[model samples]
Target: MATQQSTGSTLTRAWANTALPTLGAILAVALWWLVTVALHIDPFFVPSPADVLDAFMRDPGFMMNETWVTFSRVLIGFGIAVAGGLLIAVLLAASWTVERMTMPLLAAINAVPKVALAPLLLVWMGFGNSPKIVMVVLVSFFPVIVSTMAGLTSTPADLRELGRSLSASWWQTFVKVRLPWALPQIFVGIKVATPLAIIGAVIGEVVSPDHGLGSVIVGSGSSADTPLAFAALVLLAITGVVLFYLIVAIERLLVPWAAAIAS
Candidate 1:
């Protein structure tokens, strides 16, 4: 009975925590609807929620397919960015000289506007997934590299010395001490980069693609289908939120101690 009661209480608290945000979202939408209706705003200029919903419902299949295409690009690009970033970070961490030599160049490259490069990438890679995936990697890679480097290098000198004193091999010491210590910071980078990956994919689609939400948005805009454009925007926002929360959920599962400490 006690265990069941405890579980019930926990669930109650979780729902309570989320309730205010849910209410706020509903209230905001209601306000939007009321204002649009009261002002007799043109749907072409500023679509009401109902208008957007109706537009989305008119052809849900097409919208869903575009959404799926964009989402798949986000996932593939994000996965590659994470893997490549971690590998590069590890290599940088292995030698201060190499880090000093390459980091400035990387920073310079990252500082350039990725959008400006999209057309070039499209030209080089052609109008397929390659350019989109590359854009996602370019946008998402820097944060992971910076965060992972910070985490790996932040291990205490005393701990590293202790490992050396124990005659631990370099690889063994890194595996046993540095890697676990770095996981939390690495996750922070992953979370930060995930949304950027989506943005990058969208940019790629905008520059070069026949399908995907970005293309749909462009087409809707060109046709003055504001409600359809708004609908696509809503889907993009939902996609970003969903991806971000998924990363958070994974972080909680993989690094429970980090999550606990954060709480």
Candidate 2:
């Protein structure tokens, strides 16, 4: 009986969470439609919700193809950023001296407006996916490195002492205690980087304007097809939301305790 009640409670909470956000989105969309209809806005300037829908339905295949191009670039770039960032974070956490020497340089590089590099990347890498992927990496890499290092270095004193009392070596202590503790923080970083990855991909696409959703947006705007441009923007927004939720889902699976503790 207790187990059944607990399951029911979980389901209730899940439904509430999902239902609330869905309701809010519906309300927002309704408001948007109402405003567009009442304001007599020009479709070429600010398209109504129906106009955007019509544009999307007009050439869904083309839109989906462009979406795939952008999505692939984001995935490739984000994947590389995750792998490389974690490795570099581990290396830095292993040595204070190395971190001190390297972090400043990384910060300096990160501080440079990433958008400025897009043109240079295009000039060097040409009109290909390589520059877009690299742009995503550059944008998303810093958060992971910073967050992972914080988690790794912030392992509880008690845990470290327990490891030492067990006669555990440095490797054993890090692998068993520090890494597990750091998983939550590492995931936080990854979540933060997700949107940045999308921004980077779009920026790269904007600079080249040859393929991807960004190119569609550019072409539409030039042709004064505001509804089509809005469609691209809507697609990009949906893509970002999906990617972020996917990361959250992975984080819940891997570090369920983090959520429990926070709540």
Candidate 3:
């Protein structure tokens, strides 16, 4: 009975969290519809909800193709970013000296906006997927490295003491104590990085890409097709939301205890 009630409570809370946002979005759409339909606003400036939906419906195949192109780039870039981040994170965790030396440089690089490098990257790396992948790696790496280091470094004092009493070697201490403790923090970085990776992909497309939501957006904006532009924006939003929830799901599966604690 208690278990049943607890499950019901969880469901209720989840529904409550989701319901308000859904309603709010519906209300916003309704308001947009009213403003576009009643106020006689220019369609190019403020497209009606129908116009955007029509654009989406009209070009389903094109959207899919562009989505595929963008998705491919995002996945490739995101993959390299994750791999490189993990390597650097491990290296930093292994050596404080390396961490210190790299910290200032990393900070400086992160401070410098990466989008500014796009044109130069295009020039050097050409208009191929290479520059886009490299941009995503550059954008996504810092957060992953920083988050992972934070997580890997956050071993519980009690666990460290226990490991010391057991005369555990450094490897044993990390494997037995620190790594588990760090997963939540590492996932925190992933949650941050996922959207950034998506954005990085879109931005890369903006500078130069044959197809993608960003290119769709750029194309529409040039022709003053607000409805199509909005459609691309909606798709981009969907992509980010989907990616975020997927990360959250993976985190829950991998760190059930931590997820439960948060809940």
Candidate 4:
């Protein structure tokens, strides 16, 4: 009976976790549908769900192509950001001098609204693809650095002492202890960076490229095609969710021990 009760409680918790937010979202959409349909508002002002879906269906191939364009830009930029951020974090973690010298400058640059710099990127990199990718790297770079540094430093003091007693080299200690401890936190930064990467890519395309989902939104807005704009946005949201979950899946695999502990 006790085992059954525990199982029931777990199942209830899982259902609540899945249902509550989904219920809220459905209710919100129904309200929007009612307002738009009942009031007979201009579809151009606030498109109905069906209109957006219809627009999506009308040019599914075209939308898919634009989505691929944006996805390529985001992945390239995010990949570069990951490689560069890890390098920077490793170097900074190793050298207090580097941390002290570079962190404040990094903070200042990160604080500058990267979106506003899109036009300048367009001028420098032009409308093809490089600017969008560069902008994505710029936008996603800082969180990775900050999260990684904190995670690296967060290695247990006792663990370091143990490593020292074992006469482990700095590389040995970091590889054995610091990096593993940092993985979860590093994944947190990655989760934060994913959407930022998407936003950066789209913003870059908006200001520069004549292709990609951002370009579709830009083109739609130019003609005041609300449904098309909304459709592009829907695609963007889907891409972000998919990318975020992919990272999550990778994290789950690499950090299964952590997951087991959590369970």
Q: Find the candidate with the highest lDDT and give its number.
A: 2
Give Cα-based local distance difference scores for all models: 0.92, 0.93, 0.85, 0.91
Superposed model 2: Cα runs more than 4 Å off: 1-8
State TM-scores per candidate. 0.93, 0.95, 0.90, 0.90
lDDT of 2 at 200: 96
151 in model 4: Cα distance from truth in Å? 0.3
- Evaluated against the true structure, the overall lDDT of model 3 is 0.85
lDDT for each residue of candidate 2 in 173-228, tens digit (9 for 90 to 100): 88899999999999989999999999999999998988999999889878889999
TM-score of 1: 0.93
The local lDDT score (0 to 100) that residue 16 gets in candidate 2 is 85
| Residue 111 C-alpha lDDT in model 3 | 83
Collision pairs in model 2: none
Q: What order do you get sorting by lDDT, best first?
A: 2, 1, 4, 3
**lDDT tens string, model 4, 96-164?**
999999999999999999988998887787779899999999999999998999999998889989999
Minimal lDDT window, size 10, model 3 = 1-10
Q: Which should have the higher TM-score, number 2 or number 4?
A: 2
Candidate 2: residue 253 Cα off by (Å): 1.4
Mind giving the per-residue lDDT tens digits that candidate 1 earns over 1-263?
54565678766878877897789889998999999999999999999999999999999999999999999999999999999999999999999999999999989989999999999997898988899989999999999999999999998899999998999998998899998889999999999998899899999998885889999988997899999999999999889989999998888887888855555
Give lDDT: candidate 2, residue 133: 95
